[model samples]
Every structure is written in C-alpha cells, then in structure tokens.
Target: MKIEAHEVERRVETFKAAVQEAGLKLTHQRLEVFRELASSADHPDAHGIYDSVKHRLPTVSLDTVYRTLRTLSDLGLINMLGTAGESIRFDANTRKHHHFVCVNCGLVRDFENEELSALQVQEDLVGFGRVLETQIEVRGICNDCRNKS
Candidate 1:
C-alpha cells in the first residue's frame, strides 16, 4: 500500500533530524535511500531497496544501501522485520502495529489490534528483563497465493 505524501514527508523529516542528532551526514544517497523505503510498504530487503535506489542513483552501490539501511535501523527510524534464519526486511512505518505475513508468498502487511497492543507482559517474562515493546506476527497464505492452488 502507498503512504500519503504528507506522511512520507514527515518520515523524511524525522530521518533528517535523527541523522543530524546522531552526528551523521545527510547525503543525497541517504536521503534517496530513505525516501525509497518510506514511499514503499512492501517490506523490502536490502537487495530490493538497492534495486530501486540504483535506478534513481546510478552511482549507488549495493553495499551503500546495506550500510544505509543498517544505520537507519540503528537510529530507530525504520524497523527490521523477519525472524532469525529469514531474510531481513525493512519497514518505514514506525507506528504501533503488527504484521500479517504470507507464509506462501512472503508478503508482510501491517495490522493493528488494540487488545494485542495493550497486552500486559507476564511476571515470569518481566523477571528475565524489561520489555521494550510487543508485536504479533500472524502467519497465513495470502489470497493471491491461496487462489493459485
């Protein structure tokens, strides 16, 4: 799904402020890379991001995209999805939400659940450490994939 132009601008501005606060250069490449991700809801991996960024920036390298994504993730401007052993995907939506993952075709869609978002952590879990956040991943075959069967 495509985000609104205003929302995209807001995110880009946030990125700019974060980059400045983190003592990082706000280069053209970094701006383009973040714009590419911010405008997309596909939850693209580094390679997917590189593919789009390279079109607009012929001088951009795959390694640069990878490093930029890593930096953005480290700055909490974007989210890194996927479990261990799975390809890491990036999401620019930083709001409180969950994911509906298509196990068959690998589509990741955002969803919101008030109950889930408000769920309290168990005492046993809290005993281990402080809980920073919570999110649920609902896995199922997407309509397109199911229809193909």
Candidate 2:
C-alpha cells in the first residue's frame, strides 16, 4: 500500500510544522526517518526503519533511529501498534480507522467501518475509566498466506 507522492509531501509538511511547533530542530536524520515511515505502509519497526534509512545515511546508528521514532510517536506524528511483550510496529496514518491483522504473516492493513467507529465502550468493560478512542483489530489469515497453506 504505497502512499501517493502528494500525501507523502503533505505528511512531511505536517511533520516539519509539528517539529518546529514543539521547539525541536528539524534535522536531516529526523526528516529522513519520518520520510521512511511516512512512505511506508508495511508498519515497520525500529530495526526495519533503521535498515532503510542506513542506506542513505551510512553513519546513522540504530540508537538514533530508535530515538527518532520515539520522538515522532511522542509528538503524535505517528502511531505505534503491537503489545509491550511483542515487537512494536509504526503506522504513519493517524486518522480514525481499524486494522485487519494477518495472524499468519503479521500483516496489518487499515480499514474504515462506520459501525465500528460508532461503537461505544460499555461501563462493564472499564468501570470508572474513560474511553478516549475505540479501535478494533480484526485478526485473520491474509489471502496470500491462506493460499500458500
């Protein structure tokens, strides 16, 4: 799921604005890191992003990539997925949407459903807690993986 060039540019602009607004310097490495994540839909992790960014920036360390990702996530410029015990994946799309996760291949795809979006958390689920957002993750085998088996 390749993002359009125009959308990528728009996201880059948003990223720059957000960085400046947060009083952070928009460095080359940070831009490259964001670009890599923005342009990708595969939901890459820190190591995956590091591998791609290292080609253009040979001096880039894995630690830098980790920190850059953390900063972007902290700034609400990106979304993080997966549980704490598992490897974390990053998604560039921050809009309201649900995910279809392939249990076999670990592929994650975004989808939008009005019904799902309108769902409300029941009081029984979170007694005194408030629900800020509701997102559903439907897990199943993807077509390719199902066919391969």
* Cα RMSD, each candidate: 1.9, 2.0
TM-score per prediction, in order, is 0.89, 0.89
Tens digits of lDDT, candidate 1, 1-149 = 67789989998998889889989899999899999999887889999999988989999899989998998899888899966677789998888899998888788888889999998776467468767888889999999998899
Scored by Cα lDDT, where does model 2 land? 0.88
Model 1, backbone clash pairs (residues 3+ apart or across chains), number: 0
Top lDDT prediction, candidate number: 1
In model 2, the runs with Cα more than 4 Å from the true position are 123-125
* Candidate 1 residue spans exceeding 4 A from truth: 123-128
Lowest-scoring 10 consecutive residues by lDDT in candidate 2?
123-132
Write down the lDDT of every candidate, Cα atoms only: 0.88, 0.88
Which lDDT tens digits does candidate 2 get at residues 1-149?
67789978988998899889999999999999999988887888999999999999999999899988988898888889975456888878777889998988788888889999999877455576766789999989999998999
lDDT for 22 in candidate 2 is 91
